[model samples]
Target chain A: MKPTSKFGVLILVAPAVFIYAFAVLLPFVGTIALSFARWNGFGTPEFAGFDNYIRAFHDTVFVSSFGHMLFYIATTLVVEVAMGLLLAGVISSGRFMGYPRVALFIPVMLPMVVIAVLWGAVFNPDFGAMNAFLSAIGREDWRQVWLGNPATALPAISLVSGWIFAGFYMAIFNAAFARLPQDVIESARLDGANERTLFWRIKVPMIRQVSSVAMLLCITGGIQGFDLFYVMTNGGPYNSTEVPTTYMVKAVFRDMEIGFGSSLSVILTIVGLVIAIFFRKWRSTRQEDVEY
Target chain B: MRIDPKKLRRLLVSVVMTMSVALTSACGSSSEEGDKTLRIAFGSNGSDGQKVWDQAAAKFEADNPGWKVEFQVQNDDLYQTVGLQNLLTSNNAPDVYFEWAGARLVNKVNAGYAADITDLVSSSGLDQQFAEGAFGTTSVDGKVYMVPFTSDVTNVIWYNKDMFAEKGLSAPTTWAEFLTLCEKLKSEGVTPLAVGNKDLWVAGNWIGHLISRSAGESVYDKVMSKQMPMNSPEFVKGLTYLTDLQKGGYVNASANTIPDNEGYNLFLQGSAAMLPIGSWLIGIAQEQAPDINLGWFNLPAIDGGAGSQESIMGVTTGYIVNAKSTKQDKAVEFLKDAFSADLVGAWNAAGFTVVAKSADAGTLDPVTQSMVDLLNSGASIVAPPDTGYDLKMADALNTAIAQVLDGVKTPQEALDEAQAKVETQ
Candidate 1:
């Protein structure tokens, strides 16, 4: 006797569903449950309905962290996504050698901890590369405490993040650009379209899906990053560079306030979901699937 | 080749079951067997200190046949903030662990993580080693929770003796004289002081000491203990002393930017004339800049101060046995043997100010002897806010100090904000 295809498919999918529930789903549920109770992570948890969420709204550090996160996201959009698109276009036009692309990608391949450390030295207030550069150029008046000042700390770390990730976005868009129909580009070129026009009109619009994906990646990655902010500033010079993740870690691990940290995490998860939904809708409204 | 449907179905089910069981297996405890093995945990104190500890453990293991010892060494920051609690909650909790002496230790005791060692301390020979009052800091409600390990005179003003001698300047004994010394240094093109508040605690401890010395320990205690608000005129008065240093350009420009280690680097390289730090500076300086002659003084007498001008800001740290350990007596024995008289001598030589009197048998460096002398001369001993009071409240007050020093907020505005933060919490 032969089994039905649907039955076979169900059997094959069962293991994956089981594993997902075990690894991802269970922890998420635990977090949600824990969010409703007060615990210091050692003793028994006391039930407190919505207290943690309410406290998060009132917590000055938690509230300000969101604003800093927004600032960080804006910088990533320009520094990572926009710069990446520019690099992909410049390299795809064949004006630069392949070595430049590889060189640009080197930071992305390097370990994040090493990069954070290197950049930390470059931004050290007493003796940093930035201040040195300013001094060398006789522009000493322009030097600032890049990581210690609230005004410049977030932007400084964002630049470091971009330095490490712009190449990643470039690689993605570069691959997308390569997959474009050659005939369409050739015909465009033959019709007296200049290189810039071809890049903007034919190749750019075709890779819209990849660029949209890249933008989303930057936003989510910006929201998720912890190592850079932690190593460079640890969210100080008075909490200027704190994001939700860093604050959450501080609360859960450092302060051992698990319920509050869990609530903050749930809030972050919801915000991520809402943005993803909004982004999908916006993208759907802006463009349709392009066929070769 | 066509596959048999029944066979394929069974194979899929088996694979799913196996993966599920294997993945879920991670949730079960990987607790080590605790019968014959001893696990001692601590925050890393540096290679020299850890080597002493490791040697002590070696002797302990040798004395006890058929037993093994393992150490869980972690960074100081990680250990204080989160590592100890994580270890305590695990199935393989350390039999013995390290902790500070105040609210931090009290927190562990309240959470049931600390073993009540009042009887143990008396019976373990620790009672006869240190002074009787030394155990007072490690107690909660008259019951001891841990064994005292090291005494750190947490904050002091260390001046370069050579520089002072060259300039014909002497260590200041009063707030006014301290100001004059700073002015003299600044006029001579030498930065007078260097402070690192990047972690907030360095400046936090300094501010706490200033408040205790200027406003009186009672007023400082009231704010930290929640009886009085931090925004009081007393608190502001204490903090202004620090701000004065900033405004005069007598401290390094990167006061709030550099870390404690880097700030010390500035002092070691002769970028500054003095450094306001704790006794730990002696160890690092001895290793990094041994040729430089070092001189120090306690917090100077502030004019119109209600508190003791000669108050010493300090904190103690020690090891605690886990309350839930299956081998509590064994852990205590390990501690006694590991921290034996000979080992105490070794630790004192390594520059750890072991409170045990037997540690005096070893040779003491001049700087270490001076530190001990300074501790002896204090009119009173006060704990730094972070160690003595609630950490969150300390953070608020310390962060306020950072903002004021950075010129981002005025003294009144910063303290008011800090007061509000503590109230809300």
Candidate 2:
């Protein structure tokens, strides 16, 4: 481009760049700097020289939160992505496709707070639909206080998270499947390829880029999980549902341990960035130079 | 250099907007405008609280011209946690803000956010009006900071009177009798205790009561002052007592799953026979389930325990002046008016149990009057343990309570872990 055109492009991008720097970059840097201090979100911040980071490493709850984050990410990847892919495939194939597609996407349109509260009521041990269903089916022994039990709280929350976003991912995958060259699938069918073979070997490979993006998003969303648990459980039942984000929030806002919370945020951001970059690189390698 | 009229107009508008933004940002700085405005923040309770505060503000404004009071009411939970801290850190903090007593209020004083109102408290002679030891939580290093207005009695075990009557039971006055009462209630297929442990503090209050009854106030005083570890035998015994009650199936099985409101519903609906909670429960119960025949009793005393049978566990809600406020004198004057007989009586009529001993409660609802009478007559009142522990320690203890009750950990183990964490902190 010519110099004048380049200058115009820079001018066009200036507002966005300024916003990103002011909102994101500055806070990111501040958080990193704060990780080394012992401030309580007030008064002079005393320099602690990596005490917060070291404490995070030694803190049992902090360590468990990271583990929970990983579990959340992995669960979202498997549950949401698999369900999304299945829904998309069904819709694209024009089989088992109906108004249910709209129903699936409705959860994504609902506010997260509403979804959390709805699911919380549903999971209520006593007077909830889940227990009521169990009683109706005469399976009362199998019924559990879903969010109140430490063993089941995280998984229950993860399942709700998947239910909330599966449709959004399904929409993305459906669009990708629509853009596929149908002739290739028809040709595969004529070549005696069964539906399973067509899907696992052909359609799956064809939508690899979309799937990679979905996986990255799912993983990142899980690691940053907060609102649902904040509304639903507040990481209760003895902090069983705690992930890094919720723990960080409690530390900074509730406990007023700004320095410690900042360290947790820094760690969470770094880990998320590393995983995201890994997925990006993996996605790049899937591009074969040949045209379909 | 000829300018288009439209372009000149646009240029002027942009300059004007920029200058306005700059001035708006500058307005937040700590400088006096023409009128001396005192931003007074309180924990809000819908329109009733607003009306009462508005009247109080009007009265203060009438008495002191050239001074203004801007009232802001915040949610109770937020005010307890981030609201006060955020205000204290900001340059435009409220001249006076509502606060809960104990470590929460003391934390502010320690952080130098609350003004030393010792002289003001003494000069106003308000110290004589408040109950003895009521100001303990609001004081730091023998200096007063908070001026309490309401004391909530947390150790009361509110029970369904009709249920107790039907079962031929009466409120027990001793721990052994309480256990027997629980067993009798259980045999009748009624849950003995209605608690929503999901909030954790609801259950924590019970633990506080048991500890107060089992080991007494001296141990807790040591623990609060860091002289005794939290895992002392007294605390462990307290935890064991609660766990034993859980093991005996006295509490609702789904108690851990429900919030405080739902647990109260269990009592209101007659599914549970009793609920041990603060004085606030009465007002909330009256508002939500007025028809329920509610009766209350203090925690039953333990036999051969060091604690006094008459001492109750609770917290007092109060106001604290900002250390950085320029209108400290005016703020103190406003607080004096705010706690006057008529104002406090008005608050009591609005369903609040103001701590001021001189405040009249004749117009209060029956339950609120009973609660006020209990507060006034109780031998000694101690703040909840959660209020004395730092927020993190309090949370850990509360979680430990839940875990122990859930059979996730033994009481000894839970207390040990909590004490270790608290000590390290």
Candidate 3:
């Protein structure tokens, strides 16, 4: 077969490269430049050097927002990725036959705004479903203003994020499970490997690459998560649930502090990239690849 | 499909040209520079708000042929998020737009977005149509930039009169009496105040006023102007009242979570005995719970309060034409028609407290009439912080209040936090 010419390859890939650069790369470069300026979304932007970055370090709200992001990442990893892995394993073992895959994925299909509205009612301090459920169970002491309390808000938001995305991860894991070598599993089963043992030792290890990817998505998605947090809490109860995005939005749009907002965005992007790179490095062990 | 290099080069060039044309067309605005249609952008008011605008448009169009009115409507949150800062800088800035008075109005003028309408108003004697002091709020640097539309009595104790009567209670007239009334309400197992402070501005406006009364207007002015620190003793003393309300459990447990509408609804549905909101509540109640009877009272007098005891937290909203617009005259005429007898009467019938002294007294309902009477009663209107001063400073102040209200921190500590935020800003 004839090899493609260099110019032909360049011509073919040019559109995709150009679109990527325009959409992602250009804005990223612009944000970095804007991070050093003092702009209020009007008039000319004045160059302020590292003032915004310096301010972010000294500002409690800006620094605390990352703390919220970490909690969000930790909670979502467990609920979404781990829960999905477990649910997939349980289904693959035929123990959870009654729960349909379609039913599980339904929450993932709903729009985020709809989800936020639904959960907002659910966590509403006065007459929300969570409080009602708690009262009905004779656990009135456990009732809480879920989204209002600073202590509970970030966790509650993470739980909502998990509820929406868990089934998505489950779908991914289930598909990966289906493609696993049946002969090895049958061999393990014949050797008196129980369901739990099979899942833990055989299946889980075989899906290392998939698990790595899932964790990567979870981390990056957590860093970028804004909508539910914005709609449900809006970094309120004194900026308790403020992730970088919400604070960025407030600074740029609400406060008209565009320079500070751009700095926050740049910080978020860098954090996302760092986490992705670190995860890739940690997951790139040559021995983890299982040969057929 | 594989092609020769010469043909491929030509193809790529054609594709580039086509893409540029497509992108250019996509970016082109629907309204051209020479368009006869005039734009007036504003946030969502209640359904009746549209009626007033429509009447204004119809009136304006009837008199001025070959011209049309277009409204760019956005939700309140969306409007607040983008606001005039983004709009004025954009290519599609509204020719006429609704704006709040005070710092926001001044900022618009400072940025040259607000057209000076003093000449327009005085020359036509339209300035005489407004109630006394209405123009003051809409003015910046001695130049009127906005035409006063509605003066919102921003924070008032809007009580369910039916609930009060059933409970054998009346509106309190002083701080001590108000606390006793709150205690009585709590003993009666009724939430005294349903505050949705999630937006910060809801109860923040009231708290700002309360603090202003306690701290004195001069101290309040200094702090808001950033001449004095937010964590000053005067501010802390003013916030003590809020903490008292919070610790007393007179406010809803979910005050920090729910939006103002939900809190107002809680009062409207008789779930909560009182809601400290604004004159705007009537507009919302008229739509959702029309038959509900509500009564209004200013913030009760504080003992030894440094400011005027009868002060009320309020702000005016008005429309301004773009400074750069060629249709400035047309926009001003459109604004005049919006305040014309029939249109303003429509506003009053819809329960809005129109700022015009010329608004028909008979058009106002009892509750609205009482509000207008309060204005006439020589009560000082303390502008709410969000619109009346720097938004960031207001936000920091509001956050401090929320922290204290939620049992998250002491008033002094919260104010310190606010001071920290202000310093960073």
Candidate 4:
């Protein structure tokens, strides 16, 4: 009966496993293979060995986009997680909590394409709402060509990313807060722990695992940012706002250099994986075993 | 009914398979004759040009029985980027598609994406109808790869006639005079040039013009063909000239950020006095700013330059067939009708210049009239660098131009970097 049960379980999972192999694994392997071949998305692919990877290392545009992604990830970590934790704490505190959760999460619910294009208009240097507000506030000098200047473009784009996904991280942290041991929180309050102390000292420490997960999600999302940059600036003003994903698109689709684009993709995947693993290891070392 | 377990399983599987087949067949039946459909893809040229294409598609379908023509109107940027590869590799590739004839077309031909149509043009006598040297870019190793349809002259400075008159300024004929005029306009608190460098290609147009004017036609041709490097002193001089314009307060403050449409619109609204744009602006101006008295002039010659002022920068955008298309003959037939006198007349009426000499140039609006005069007087026509180089190299050059405008790199440094990248490619 035990052997039969194992066989039944195998049969049940076979379809999903086959689909994963066909759809995900197959294309991934194909991409890796094509990364080493010189194919322009047409005709027969020529063997190019490590030439594509070699070229990528020397590519200034690729390097610039990679640097931009690092800046974006750093900002996302600070903005999304920090704002998310604050909102989650306030919402969980039951202060004006009657406001629906959907209101805060609305930006996350909107499609990324919609958010990017909306932000693009908002960031328009002339007649955009951002500059208009600055002028109305008598801060006209503070106004900038947000997505147009090479110096300001990446940071401006990062602000939009943080705005759109802060809500998503808030939802994640809210769920974690809801699952927190109410007995422990109440005990801390009874021990004369103020709301701030409880939130920072006890609640934060208790939800370390959840916060780690949220950070990991934000990191990966920032590293793979494409739609926002593609819609807003298209990595323009001399590729200042470029990221790994947008650069890959330009190489593969725009430039018709499949090998170079695929190589960039592989490098992006490796970078994401390494950062995620490092984060996991770092978080695990600080994690404490808790008993109910 | 009672049944064995294995038999019941087989019966269920068969029933599911039959249902799935029926569902798939229903969806596939509508587009089964998609092969018979002649798909023509073109860059979106406002609504008027789209209507012209639609009419041509209707006329072509009417002329040929048992054939359906589908018009795929795509945004220009998308068509040149992801859309191109997707169309070429798909089973239902466009039978006829728009293409810039030069290194871009050559890249497609080398990759076996473009069909060789040399014999077809010769047998049909289509070559005789086009102007001399019209097929130069479309030809690779003496074999025609595409057919020219639309032609344009770039680097034409479109200025507001009323503003020029109010300011007591005439179009300058030399680079020094142009600088003086710009300075004069600046002193009067007017933005001398409404530029949109955000699009990159808009800036690329100026670079191509300056190079052609500074380096001369012969030298520019050699540079484009890779016989000489792009980091040559002539190119550096051209880059310096462009940088000086930006530094001299001749261009708008928002030049780096504004989209091309907004910049050109500023000129139309009398906010800016001048616009250095291609011939296509004539049509747009005619539609959007009909009341504004618009005037155009060729890019001024550099002081003591080797190039003739008459060496104009231009390009011929045309239609090319898919190499793997099964209905090549039918597609060529559609192209013939698409380029017929009636269709060409419609395009010309819509403010386009057709390459076919027999095609009418319409009533010749003042702007178009100036363009025609300038093109006719050209000693040699040089295709824009963006057209003559592959997209990757062109992108590098565009970036270099932007960096120069941003004052991040000196002219020599930028050109040297761009030339280095091109050489490696």
| DockQ of structure 1 | 0.50
TM-scores of the candidates are 0.92, 0.93, 0.94, 0.89
Docking class of 3: medium
Q: B401, model 3: CA deviation in Å?
A: 0.8
lDDT tens per residue, model 3, A1-292? 5634666667668889989999999988888999999987778899999999999888889899999999999999999999999888988887666657777789999999899999999999788999999999999999999998888888898899989999999989988888999999999999999999999999998988898889999998889898999899999888999989999988898888889899988888888888888878878854658766
Task: Tell me candidate 4's fraction of native contacts, as a decimal between 0 and 1.
Answer: 0.46
Instruction: Judging by lDDT, tell me the better candidate of 2 and 4.
Output: 2
Each model's C-alpha lDDT?
0.85, 0.81, 0.86, 0.80
Which digits, one per residue and each the tens of the lDDT, describe model 4 over residues A1-292? Answer: 3433444455456657867997999999999999999987777889999999888888877877888988989998878888889988888887746565677789888998999878877988756899999999999899987887787888888888888878888888889888988999999999999988988988778888788889988888888788988888888877778788988887887777888789999998998899899988888897584554
Q: Can you tell me which runs of candidate 3 are displaced by over 4 Å?
A: A1-18, A98-100, A285-287, B1-12, B18-37
Candidate 3: TM-score? 0.94
What's the CA error at residue B78 for candidate 3, in Å?
Answer: 2.6
Fraction of true contacts kept, per model? 0.54, 0.44, 0.73, 0.46
Q: Which residue window of length 10 is worst by lDDT in model 3 chain B?
A: B356-365
Encode model 4's per-residue lDDT on B1-425: one tens digit a residue: 64455555566557657866887787566343446799888778788788777787788788877788987778888888778778777655787888887888888788787899888876766777777877776788988889898778877788898889887899999888999999999899888888877768888877777877777877776776778887888878877888878789787766767678888987898778999889888767777988898787778878877777767778878999888788788877777776776676677777778776655554666667667667767467777877876666567677788878777789899888888777656
For candidate 1, give the lDDT of residue A237.
Answer: 82
The model with the greater TM-score, 1 or 2, is: 2
Worst 10-residue stretch by lDDT in candidate 2 chain B? B2-11
Better of 2 and 4 by TM-score: 2
